[model samples]
Target: MTNIDIEIPHPIAAALTILVALCAIVTVDHFTDFQASAGGRAPEEIVRDAEGEGLRLRQQQAVLQKREEILRYQLEMLREERRLRGPGISAAIEADIDRSEQMLLDLIRDQQEAEGKIMLTLKQIWDAQGRAISISRKAGKGVISLTWPVEPTLGISAGFNDVHYEELFGMPHKAIDIPVDQGSEVRAAADGVVEDVSDNGYGFNSITIRHNGFATLNGHVESFLVEEGDTVRQGQPIALSGGRPGTRGAGHITTGPHDHFELIVDGERVDPMLYLPPVPN
Candidate 1:
């Protein structure tokens, strides 16, 4: 090896260096492209997949949010019930409380299934209530007379077809809500036979009394004092007022202790105030 010195032009040397750098870059880019293609998805497909995943996550979040809301409401009911459970409770009442708690837990586990069952139960109860009213209309042939179901001392909390109720529950309130103390006496609005007593498991326990050409429903009752088919006189005690959250008869939604009263005339729900005496000042 004989050593010979050859000096190249600076401009040509610079051009060669740039060319080599360009080739390296091209090789690296090709390798990266091949690696990406090995996954059997194009760049656009990868981007689309990411977008789809994000959408799915968002939908799942929405479902979870709704579930959380339902759980919160149920939990509030549970807490109220627990608070109402005092010491020295009777065994029968304790067992009922346990069942109620279990029902709430089951609802939390399977909301959709529980909701379906509740809807079905309500439908059946509603049909029975309607039948009771129909029977009353057919059985009697006298003029309608009415009395107050509860003392007018508390006045009315919510009225017939209450707009606020419709806004809150998305349905018109066909009855009236009379604010009364918990465990207050609920009296019969008129002389009638007790046709039905039922509970809808959501805090609505009611008694329907059939009178001449009309019917009366007293909801949010703690307990029935009279049994079905028993004749009751006007101003007679029929039930204890409820509507206290977490109590025996107070359903899921209630503002406070009160009575939900309905008066049906001609098979239609009308304003109870129209038929009842004016509230005492």
Candidate 2:
């Protein structure tokens, strides 16, 4: 019987080690199913997706911000009531104030979160005119239809009366006044570009949208949602009604909180009832 030890040279041993490492790497790579840096998506596609997300987030944030403003305004009203009512109604007023305060706080938090999301979205990636063009295409489908600027349940407070101020302006009172609760949403009558959003010299916040062969004016609004030059679809909220003849953001006078809706055709004031459907009882 004999025992033998096989000795290998250092160079051959090193070569064997290198071969094993190469084989291990190839096996791992083959089994792993590796992906591209962008997770098999094209870089351009990723950018486009990010931009879309950003746009959506911005819109959502805007909505949340509007809600916050409404809550704050409500809170102010509640406080004013509490002050005027005095302790006789303190118990009820206090409860309402407490609830309003809580709601306002919650809305603020939500708005902050939405704002943060928008900021993060912007940081991650990203079109103003392009969106407007897309909206235009979508709005152009079918014949243009108009939606009631205010809820139809509320009937016209003042019927169209052109002769009321015919001397000052031949077509004065051409617009019907549809009274609604203050701070109520005022939507677009039809798809169109926001031709103007003016507060100065008008005595009230007003939004005018030019549609096909006609235009609509929404006045006595508390606040505007859409800015000048923005494209809005029918039924989209353009402003909040400033109910009553109160001195709101603009000093526009009204019998009460109402939506002053005016229709203009070929730059001439016309009765809105001519085109608007009758309100359901």
Candidate 3:
């Protein structure tokens, strides 16, 4: 019979071979880990872990945001309390105070109005009494009559050509102008009681006398003959010759020496020719 040879590996070498296989497998895993973030795990599992971490971080941020909101609310409440405690109150509260103050002011105004009315009543009574006393005088009872107020030489010439005569009455020209010289002689046309002897400035004097409602005016005269309270006769020499001759009155010596004579009936001036006898030119 022929004998056959069989080879068997040693135990130590078999263990070394197994160790080498383990080392080779570890080297492959390290190489893969160096190149990629995950080592052979499912894509879903890796994504799920990432999402969980993000969720945790978001929750922490949410907690911080809640803390900030609470602090803001607390600060706002403290300010509100301080404002309400001092003069920093709301506008609505101030408006109510203003309304109460205005009500008191209105009461004061009402009391002042009542006092003013009472004083006005008393003043009216005093004025009426003084006016009544003045009405009882005898001086105002006299009548007024105009005089042929120029020198005898000017008698005809004084009342001559008085055409625009009616322009002497009513409204603003309530008084007619009897232009005479600053020093021309003036005579009474009729009997009259003198009321006022007034200086109408410009060296031209005026005589206002009364004959009932007939008011006679001798204006622009230089001097006066009859006093304020004198009674003049029909042909009496009442005023001296003239005025600032050739001025506004223009009662000069020659033709410019004219008398502006007016006769006022019922507080209104009328043409003097209506009363004077026709001149014997």
Candidate 4:
């Protein structure tokens, strides 16, 4: 219950206050520098890390898919055994089926996680490589016209927003699918700079080009003729279409050999038909 008060000289007190303030500022500056060093990776390093992630993602997808196929086969065998062996075998067969089902569920969860990682890696690559280029409509220079990406006009197998694609893929198809041989040459739709060339490992491979303010994507390509940063002209061959099942660059979702062409206007995927010439009858 005793209080003691000590009064120091005003000049000394002011110096102490200033010293404390300086220390606080120094602490904040040090913390900020630490954060920058931790978070600010060089763009080259980011792209390299993203590329490594992409490679691993592809390998993970292949392993998961093979496991899924094996599990599905085991389930089928179990069901057949239960059907042929009757009630006495029901208990054992049912147990096997349950185990297989749980495994499939786990595989699905893992596959989803792998998918997410690949997507994140792709975004990182895009960010590091300046793939998010946008050109305003005015900057794009009025309505832009594009040529068909594939020669010989094999005809569109899946039109943009096709109901079958939506039902099969569980999402609206934002691109046009043109049926062509697996190695058919894919041409650029318009004059642009190659922005990115990537594969999602689960079969989706694509080349993106930045055209003024608009961008075009040629997906399901087996190989690229042009590299990133290449300047291409309209109708120039840029890649080879590949969407054959069990083939390189052809993901599982594709029906067959085809080109998945997408046109992006101001960063939004729109129907490629809006820009391309009409399909031949």
Candidate 5:
């Protein structure tokens, strides 16, 4: 324009513009191809991925459940403390309790959406701890057998030597051993599995009874009335006085017409005299 001259641009300029446009078009096409390849996943594979995510959620649910339990316990303990506290602590404790209650409300809302298992677990834990007892017995629930398991007295004096009791071990004899005539009735104190029937060792015709978690050992039996895996109930005769039929090394004591009885807890032997009835001297 300065020279007032009309000049045509080189064809190479137009060619270059077209070349740049083509390059851009080709780049866009390749980008679209990459997106298609990246997005191509089977429905089943996606479902599996989702299922894996669900499993992770389940693990999180378990953690949340435990947290909920801890929170609930704290709340209960605080409440109890507040109840026991006098007027001097009432105001401050009330405020703290309100705060805890609010926190628990939020937690409960979160847990509710995660299914009711958290609540159930918390309730079970509280109930178990609150009672300090185990159920699985007909007469309420207790880990220990409150009632005695065997016959009151078969009426033969095995003497004052009751060694089945770990408690009476300090003295020469702790139990009032009752001697049963050979083939006299021997029974299970409670419902349990037959741990073993042995003829030798401490118990001749020994039958180990696991009553819930408590244990009872009857040694020096005449014969085994029940086989292994046989379930026996309270007072169900599982053996007889005297000794086992065969000395197959069943872990029983090989001795006498009298059954040597031992009451055990966990694994340690406890004194049976605490529950046993009075025997005539």
Candidate 6:
């Protein structure tokens, strides 16, 4: 039996061993880098990063809370200002009052109109009983209701159908005449749109307002505060009353300074007193 000795190269063996060790070291470093990204960092580093992120989030929350507080303070201030101004003084409150008052006036007008119808029915019943119903022409003319157009200080110089005056008509005057001081304000009887503003060269400055189904005429006006096609609310000033005996716009048929007020229903002239608020005592 012959014994054979195998010779291995030292440099090749050493290089092979070094390569294996280098591969093991590279694999360990790669795993460590992966662990750091996956939240497996060193304990001290993890705590430091967590504290920083928490502080940042808390700061953001504080900022948001501060903004909320500022908004709340501003809202409170606005409320306080409104409270200090007193009731019915704010714009919204004033608007509400105006709306409510207008609605109430309108309701009253409707109720009065209904009452007029009821009175007419009562009159018919009386007539059926062989009793003559003496309906006051001035008080109940079966007409729609309206707000007063003039101030209380004024008085009716001539009534709707006074046969005493020739200028007022031979039998029945179509309108009423209320004496007013110079430059007295004349308001609308109800909500309406101005249909016409005309002047008769003889002396009648008239402003006609068209309502729901009726209309009102403000005649013998000195000057008009509203124009044709203008919308007016009930009791809204439409003209300055001026129809004196010698005024520029005084009606030729009018005896003195007065507002020749007329109410027309469905195109037919009616007595104004029946619709207007009662004459001030």
Candidate achieving the largest lDDT: 1
Model 4 over residues 198-274: C-alpha lDDT tens digits? 86553467788878668877776888899998999998999988865434565444545688877777656688786
What would the TM-score be for candidate 2 when compared with the true structure? 0.46
Q: In model 4, what lDDT does residue 41 have?
A: 68
Q: How accurate is candidate 3 locally (lDDT)?
A: 0.47
Ranking under lDDT, best-scoring first? Answer: 1, 4, 2, 6, 5, 3
User: In model 6, which range of ten residues has the least summed lDDT?
Assistant: 129-138
Q: How well does candidate 4 score on lDDT at residue 268?
A: 64
lDDT-best of 4 and 6: 4
Tens-place lDDT per residue, model 3, 170-281, is 0122222344333566787777677666543333345666654356666555567788778887878887644322233222111223454555554334566666655446
Q: Which stretches of candidate 4 lie over 4 Å from their true place?
A: 1-142, 200-202
Off by over 4 Å in 5: 1-141, 146-176, 199-203, 243-256, 277-281
- Give the number of the best model, judged by TM-score: 1
Candidate 3 vs candidate 5: the lDDT winner is 5
Worst 10 residues of 1 by lDDT: 59-68
Which lDDT values do the candidates have, in the order given? Answer: 0.71, 0.60, 0.47, 0.65, 0.50, 0.59
Candidate 2 — which pairs collide?
Answer: 243-257, 244-256, 244-257
TM-score, candidate number 5: 0.37
69 Cα displacement, candidate 2 (Å): 34
lDDT of 6 by residue, 124-155 (tens): 32222111111111122333659878865657
TM-score-best of 1 and 4: 1
Q: For candidate 1, lDDT tens digit of each residue in 1-281?
A: 99998766697888899999999999989868875775857767677757856754564444344553443454565455556666766676556556656665776788776455434433443555566557656545667678888887868878999986544443347789998767899999998889888865554688988888888888878888999889999999999988654566765545457888888776677788988888999
